[model samples]
Target: MAVDAAPRRTGTGTNQEGVRRHNLATMLRQVHLGGPTSRAELTAAMGLNRSTIGGLVTELTSLGLVTVGSAPAGPGGARGAGRPSPRVALAEAGPYVVAVDLGVDQVVVARVGLGGVVHERVRGPVDPDAEAWQVGAGIAALVRRVVRGAPAGAPLAGIGMSVPGLVRRSDGLVRLAPNLGWVDVSPGSIILAALGVDVPVSLANDADLGALAEHGRGVGVGIDDLIFVSGNVGVGAGVVAGGQRLEGSGGYAGEVGHMVFDPEGRDCHCGSRGCFETEVGAHAIAEAIGCPVDAVGSLGDVLDGYATPPPALHRIGHQLGEGLSGIVNAFNPQVVVLGGYFRALHRLVPGDIAAGVHARTLPAPLESLVLSQPGLGADSILLGAAEMALEPLLADPVAGLQASLAEASSRLAG
Candidate 1:
């Protein structure tokens, strides 16, 4: 007889001490995702005995990762059936990660804590025409300012940066960022040198991080296969398949902007003709709407009229959908989330965009596909970066925390 099996979860293997660490991370993640939960619920969810859950909760409480509080009274104004199980939640002032979203025209830095909370943030503009090193210096300065304001004694988990271009996953290097006019820049080292810190750094594409943020904490949560498309000064995508981010060979899988859509279209900075970016990029939209390339703010103001978008905006939406249809046909994703300018445009001219996509793509994939806007809005990339920084800690909380503390101690002594 032919039999079917259930899907297996990944990254659950552990060493002798790995069990303890993994259990701690699991508990923390549960509370982080579902909000405050009762101890009994956690025990049931984890499939662990009550004693083990108690011990893990004690350790977490001692480390300031979570706090245990009395459960609320039942509907009848009396405590629940048995002894009321204490609720657990992430500590409000615990450790945090520094998240940087380096866009073409601005830099945003945020302090994000466990459970995907943004405590504080700062933003400043940058010159896209400036030298790569100059931009790096500006970003480093902004990062320093944000770090300085972080809670005292909070363990610095790591730094996660989201760049508006292609990044090599092996090393946090910017291979090319056409929108920012940067090439072959090592932003991680530049920022680390500027800060004189020994913290770990993770760098990735802005759209990639946005996809991750949406999948883990936003609208796409629990959706394994989806594509996040971001339109700003550039167009790009982050693809997730089988519950994992798909970074192709050399980590350039999601450069959807470079896909040629028109053979006789405008020239792209990537040295290509008629690329999708040349059709729907912010600069392209601005040009179509009779605005300067730097007049994105004014362009946004004009496009904010969703009830009656201009002809130029409608054309942009059509072009965007045309480009996205190919993606839908090829990847057949469960959903396609729009971010950055695309989100706004989608809100304004969803019908035109849908018409374009429906006209181009095959019926099956398009029928099951969901087109939506980002839930986190402007915060998606930053929150995703924070998630990158917090990943290691979540995988092995005890070891990660110990290493961070030791590094902090060493820095102080030196």
Candidate 2:
């Protein structure tokens, strides 16, 4: 779990008791990110006065959302003149969310607590050709397996899913996941139906979530302009500009993979010729490396162990850079993260990609550009999903907790 890079600025809570829910949620978010912060630190970071911060912490304590430690909790653990502010940390037995990263070759389900803690997780292979319902059912099973180990009273929050496709932002409908052979599938609904649970579920494109996680807590922390390029079965990106997502009108903004790389090169699954994905996606990399196409989905680990660079790999690296140039020119991001198999690719050909982007990008965009790998490794999308799932609770803790408790009671009664 990673600490939030930038804390929210809405903590100067109002004096009105009606808005206590907002103040409590704000306080919880602070502890979840800052980790075991003191009353003094919370005041400074959240812009709330000491008494207001104290009152909110007390309420969260009653709800089992956080616990006060006995140790000195001064900033950096230094003691002050007066008695030290109580050390506030996320409760060890607090609520948890289910986070699923559905991939072409693998699926990861995790029980994630506040402060980004992964209490338990399950990961395994999935057939790309499997029906969406079958895959969703299997993922529900994985979710159940992962959450079995949570502390007894830890309530189940919402579920958030990440898929490598164009997900309709408004409805969690997966419009097209060509690599998975899915079209207009509602993965969230299927998983909830499979689990027979009443909790809410949300889904989003994997690349977009990857960028969200990175910008919020990973290597792209504090970077307002970033591009997270995912090299799963396809080549796609998540863009953040001015600290917000750059989703297009149709929620298909970052389809750089389908952008024309070479009009005459290769045919793409999306009925296009010479799309960028056709030249440098997982299959292309596998073919270039002389491996079976079926094994392409899980090639990151295999490709990473190459101590001696293969000629095919070097060529693919050049192709990767050539393809990225167009994206770099258009986004003008401060950071471009190479995720999934691209991480391994970057390790093999950092220079070629850098040179290619530099050669193609306009002078202004290239000046502050940085090419980096995902700090969370394979967990970027997974954690991003967790972040999304926990949004409800973080926004309004009272309502979120009440909903979970009511659902739990109903399950037991039934």
Clashes of 2: 0
lDDT of each: 0.82, 0.83
lDDT (10s digit) by residue, model 1, range 1-414:
111111224466445465676688888778777889887788778887789889989999998899998888877888857877678989987778889988877788887889999888888887857887787777777766666665667777888999988899899789998777778889889877866778888999989999999998888887999899987678899999988999898777899999999999988889999999889988888877777767673344446654677688778788788899999999999989998888878888899899889889999998899999898886788899999999888777787787565344234223
C-alpha TM-score for every candidate: 0.91, 0.91
Superposing every Cα of model 1 onto the true structure, what RMSD results?
4.1
Poorest 10 consecutive residues by lDDT, candidate 1 = 1-10
Worst window of 10 by summed lDDT in candidate 2 = 1-10
Error of 1 at 259 (Å): 0.7
Cα lDDT tens digits for candidate 2, 200-229: 788988999999899877999889999999
Off by over 4 Å in 2: 1-18, 72-85, 405-414
51 in model 2: Cα distance from truth in Å?
A: 1.0
Runs of candidate 1 exceeding 4 Å displacement: 1-15, 72-84, 297-302, 305-307, 405-414
